[model samples]
Target: MRPWLRIKGVFVYLRAFFSFVLGGLAAGCATVGPDYAGPPATPLPAAFTRAGEPPEAPRVAAWWNQLGDPTLASLVERAFAANPSLAAAQARLLHVRDMSRTERANQMPRGGADLFYAHARLPSMSGGAEDGSQLPSRLDLYNVGFDATWEIDLFGGQRRAVEAAGASVQAAEANLADAQVSLAAEVAQLYVDLRGCQRREALNDDAIARQQRGLDLARRRREAGTASDLDLARLQGQLEATRADTGQLAAELDGYRNALAVLLGLPPGTLDDELAKPAPIPLPPTAVAVGDPTALLKNRPDIRAAERTLAARTAQIGQAQAARFPRLTLMGLIGIGGSHLSDLAHLDDFTALAAPRLRWNFLDFGRNAANVDKAEDMRNEAVSHYRAAVLAALRDAEDALARFRQRRVTVATLARAVEAARRAADLTRERERAGTTTMMDLLDAERTRISTEQRLASAETALTGDFVSLQKALGLGWAESPRH
Candidate 1:
């Protein structure tokens, strides 16, 4: 037959084969395994037991801004821009998206060109006469052509793989968001600690100063024989203790600042100058916008990631199930060859080939079934993981809310104690000026006020920390967080 006619025959065969396969892929039969439904819904509480007052509306994405601390907000932004962990998570998400695209691309036909060259020398016939019955022959062969192969997704294997990859991309996205949520909470908590440490230092300094004055008054009284030496020694002890506490607070303040610098991906001492002065801890609002547990389950990033993972695993089951069925692949090739460059132009030198390949593991004695079983088991594990994540999220929110509630009580109590002590000190000072109270009595009242002030600072700091934890548990603040 002429080369053109042979090529036409090959094209005809390929055209028909690919038409059938592509048509099958376009509107294929149902996939082999069960379709993916989401993880089972978890039961949720009606309202948080510790929610003090219902918020006016749902909390916005920028929950940290509600705390009213510009410095904390700035610090969080800096961390988002520079934190290594968050950067890695973002990279992983991109990688999964790329994989999803690659898998989806498999649904379409593939085509590529190949070039080949070959050289060979024919050997003499073994039973021929030595006198050139079969002479040594040498030939050079070269061919170039386009080749194409497309696997028809008759059982939806490729589609299921693409589905799983898409779900994996979503899971990776949720992971990145979860990382951001945790990072913001860490920065806020550290900032709160730093502020608390500075506040305590100031309180310590105030107490030390007050005690020094008391010691001075006692010295004058002892000289005048109006106060005992024991009183002076006791005042000295009180002053020394306050000074010691002040030193510890100063050390803790430096440590917290350095930690904040690390969290922002900066070297130690980077934030020292900026945080040198004392600042008030950010306060939380009275009514927190904590939606019900069911809504919270929907919003939490960890839970979302788990759910997506389950979806991906469920898709894997279909992919495995599809493997048990036969695969139909359509492939075709065209090429040209000749002993001489001039001969390559002849239609007789061209060659064309077409084939429809079918593959199955029909004789693998239960290997495919075992794979299906494994995939199903993994899918079950994913379902369990998703449930566990939901339970953990609920527990975290409940605990944080409970702590925030109790912390408020503690803060309020300390505030009242400090106020009462301040008033008592004022009365004692008045009594001293009027000559009705001794110097010792006045000094004692001042010490009480300063001590109460220290407690109030710590309680207030803890309350703010609890608020940050609650927001983290609720998975707020990431949507508005700076992304790098």
Candidate 2:
């Protein structure tokens, strides 16, 4: 046939082949297996059992700022930026997003350029001389070409794979958000504990000073032959005990600082100089805005991650089902080559090839059916996991709410006790000055006052810690922007 006629025939064949492929693609829109219809509905209460008159609006994203502590806010922001765990989660999100892109690209044609060189030697085909020695034939060929391949998604297998990949990317993003929420809460809790320790240390200092004064008074009375040796010994022991308590507080303060440093991605003790000075514990606002349980389901990162995972598993069912059908692949190559390397550049001396393939593992001893069944099982497992996540999130929110409410009551009661103790100490001091009570009575009153104050400080710190937990349970620390 003439070269021009051959080229025209090839064009006609390619056109018909592409038309058939397009028709097949149009018909392949019917995906196998069940289509995803979103997550199953989980029964949720309109409001949390422990949340009383919570606000309708969702909690703020940066809930740490509600504590009104600049230092804590700064620490939380630092953790978001530098915490190793959060950074790792962010990297995972990027990795999953790239994988999703790869899956989507699978549905499109792939083409690449190729350059190849070859050298070969073969023995003579005819009989050699009687001596059995002959020069071998030599051949060399060079080629430059462009090749393309496309796997037609005739049963939506690739489509389902891409869908699953996209869902997995979403799950990774939610995981990153969860990491951020956890990190922020940890930073705040440590900071509160550090300050609370400092407050207790200060109380110990005051107690130590008071005990020293009582000891001095006891010494004067003993010299005056009015106080017993036992009284002086007891005062000295109390002074040393107060001093020992300060030592414990110092160690605990160091621990809190170290933990906060680690949460901010710094070595332990890195925050020592910054947090050594005493400060009041960061206090939460009187009324925290905890949204309803429905909002909690939508806002919690773990719940979102679980739901996305379920979606990915559901898509996998279609991917496995589609594998039971045939797959069609089209491949084409166009190149110029000859025995001489120079011919590689000669456009007129060219070769062209087009091949179409169909593949089906129709007789695999039920392997494809088993794969489909396994995918369905995975999807069912994911459904259970998603439901479990929903319930766990609800439980966390309710438990945090209850703790926060009860902590507030405890703090108030301690505050009242502290006031009562202070009044009693004042009365006893006046009595001692009037000579109506001994120095021992005055020392006892001061000890009770200091102890009550210590209890109040500890309760206040716990209340703030509970507030941090509440914010964490509400999934309030992650930003609204897409993390990955």
Candidate 3:
């Protein structure tokens, strides 16, 4: 070959090599998975009508703090730290992070080492001079080698896998947050119910005392032949019913206490002493912000988590589709191994030479095609799930706002009914004493007073419950909490 021609050929080869390297870099940039597009913007209200209301302040970390009950706050903190379900969710997030790491490793170079050693024994040579056969001989052999493999990611399949894994990690993180929100809301609701039960028990205790007094008066009248036996028995029944209510409320209180203890990851009955004391449910600050419905999409952990999952499934579809294309893998071995350790450092060993390899799964076309189809189907399912979650969230918010407004009205009405009933009961007693009213009238008045009082108590409980529900609907359990 001419010297000038050789130079030209070498230059041509150098240009091709550089071009190939640049092409590989460009291909690596292309991630095979479905590119993630952010959630579709849903039309939302310009502003929240209830925004101006004196709702409780929103809290981001430990929303139970807004309840303003020290015990409740402490319990919520403990639950966040120790609850098994929450812990499990957190662990799942960590696992997904590791899985992402594993996928990323596929984009990196791989190598391994190998060592080999052998020993051989040779029998004495039979043709040696008379009676002078050679003694058995022993031989030893050693070999060492190194090996490595790397996938070029020509089709971006590995990149897509990594992208999917990363999305899964994000989804898992959102799942943990969702668990926290749910746990906090549940704890708060149970605590509220417990407090309400205590209030009812107290009210019933008062009613029992008043009914006992009425019964005693009835006994005095009957002894004087002024009241009938039927009147005394009716009074007795009223007293018994009042006492039963106290027991019922007490039982309900126990159940709630037990439930709270379990939520805090404690053994049954652990909270009996702490929660046994009756305390009113803490109300959120009036200025708490219930941001617009659009804001809720961001605040609600479940919604965010579901959206992340959808994104991950979309990425998986890309990964699956990439599998249908050619995969270029570069594999090499660089490790050294020997039967004897002494030979490992020898450069002339069997594995000292550089080795490069390539692999491709060019067959099984139908299987790869099916996987791509399945991934696309899953992506579709995920999109539907995300949409459903958004609708459900909006419904919850609307229901809570309306119910909260109605509860306030109901409470006001019940308060008036309670006052009127108390006055009627007083008037009936006064008239009976003056002999202007019969025993039957007094009994009717007593029943009406107790019924009204019960209704009032129930309404009070319901009002607080509605408030809790509204907070939950607003996704305020973790986003907005009351002030200290």
Candidate 4:
């Protein structure tokens, strides 16, 4: 080799060695961009209040089971298994997990193989050829090769990308949990509605029986020439109105059952045979101890999802920053390939030849800069979203608690009204027997009693719904064990 060329080669080797050392130092000693520390803290309550005191709340899983209905428990379980939307969410989580695994695999070595065949004719080089003309000679050739490629993570770029993908997988998993929580709550609410419908149906049946008896008595009095025509007409009208209301209530009950059936993922019109009977709603406990508000940040799936998203965005910034630096890749190709069919098994020939390649893009500095800027913007957006989600979650819990407390008082008041109305109905019946009041008066009292009963039932149903809402707001449904 020429002296100058030899010296130049040595200098080139020294430069490459120093570059390798510098890249290692950059990777090991420094990571570009901000490292993620969790979201900032906000003022939060230590515990939720109930009935003006701190309550001892039991941790319950399968929270819907607290309603004390086995059928409802079964229905919710079936819906979770059969609901197409929930199944789709679960599938999405699996897909993201697979994608994350694939990304992680990308940061490591990859193996590959290849085979080829070629047959081409070329002009002979011999001058003795028949009247050899002044033409360039050509030849026939055949070759085969195999290769492999691997990118060495010199700047932790690939590693950061894998880290971001893993966080995304975590976010997807949390989303699946959120879906489950929502489905369970929906099923519980529907079940409560069904029970409320049954209660109303019972009230209607009682009202119709009482009104029919009043009409019969009025007819007897009229035939005996005691009750006036005006009184008889009033009784007739009242009885007919009560009958109409009964029919309407029955129809509404049927509608409620149908809605429940659909929520359980059953075909329409299938609930009549199984759920026709009137079932009373069980009262949920008045004492519920909601833990510290900060606990929600970990217990709630939506909160976890937001946190994971933040982590993913934080890692993405590293990936973007790495792009600003030169990329170093290690590449090779190796395969047991041959032209002839028999030569496929010949590993010796294949092992004799392969190339290790390296490529680096020296230009396009602006391209990498744009990527970094984009990543930074996305990171900022994620941070904002996470903060907003946390605040929203806190508000949901507080609002649900406040509503539940107020509904409890409303239900108790309605229960008292129902009792007073029932007493008035009994007194009116006594007066009708003694001739002090007409049949029309007794019918009015009976109808009022029935109406009050229905209202009380409705208030009870509302209270149940509010309690379930509180459960969701607390994010207590996804505990590992049953919280009964």
State every prediction's TM-score relative to the real structure: 0.92, 0.93, 0.83, 0.84
Clashes of each: 0, 0, 31, 8
Clashing pairs in 4: 60-483, 61-482, 61-483, 146-333, 147-333, 147-334, 148-332, 148-333
**Which prediction has the highest lDDT against the true structure?**
2
Q: How well is each residue in 15-37 modelled by candidate 4, as lDDT tens digits?
A: 45545644765556444666778
Q: Sorted by TM-score, highest first, which candidate order results?
A: 2, 1, 4, 3
Q: Rate the local accuracy (lDDT) of all candidates.
A: 0.85, 0.87, 0.74, 0.74
Cα error, candidate 4, residue 43 (Å): 2.9
Clashes of 4: 8
Name the runs in model 2 displaced over 4 angstroms: 1-20, 125-136, 481-484
Query: Residue 413 in candidate 4 has what lDDT?
Result: 93
Tens-digit per-residue lDDT, 1-484, candidate 1 = 8877876777687788778667756675667777886688777778877677573346636688888989988999999999988989988888888889899999888999887777898875544556646654777876778789888888988889999999998888888889989999999999999988888888777878888988998899899999898998998988887787766787898899998899898999999999998888789987777887877876798998999999999999999989989988888887776666565667665677778898987998999899999999999899899889988988898899899999999999999999999999999999999999888898889878888988898899999999999989888767632333
**Per-residue lDDT of candidate 2, residues 43-105 (tens digit):** 888778898645676565788878888998899998888999898998888899999999999
Error of 2 at 476 (Å): 1.4
Best by TM-score: 2
After the best TM-score superposition of candidate 4, give how far the Cα of residue 314 lies from its true spot, in angstroms.
1.3
Model 3 residue 262 CA deviation (Å) reads 1.0
For candidate 1, which ten residues in a row score worst on lDDT? Answer: 475-484
lDDT of 4 at 81: 74
Model 3, 104-214: lDDT tens digits are: 987787766566678998875764657777654776777655455555666677777887898888788777777877888788788878887787777777778777888
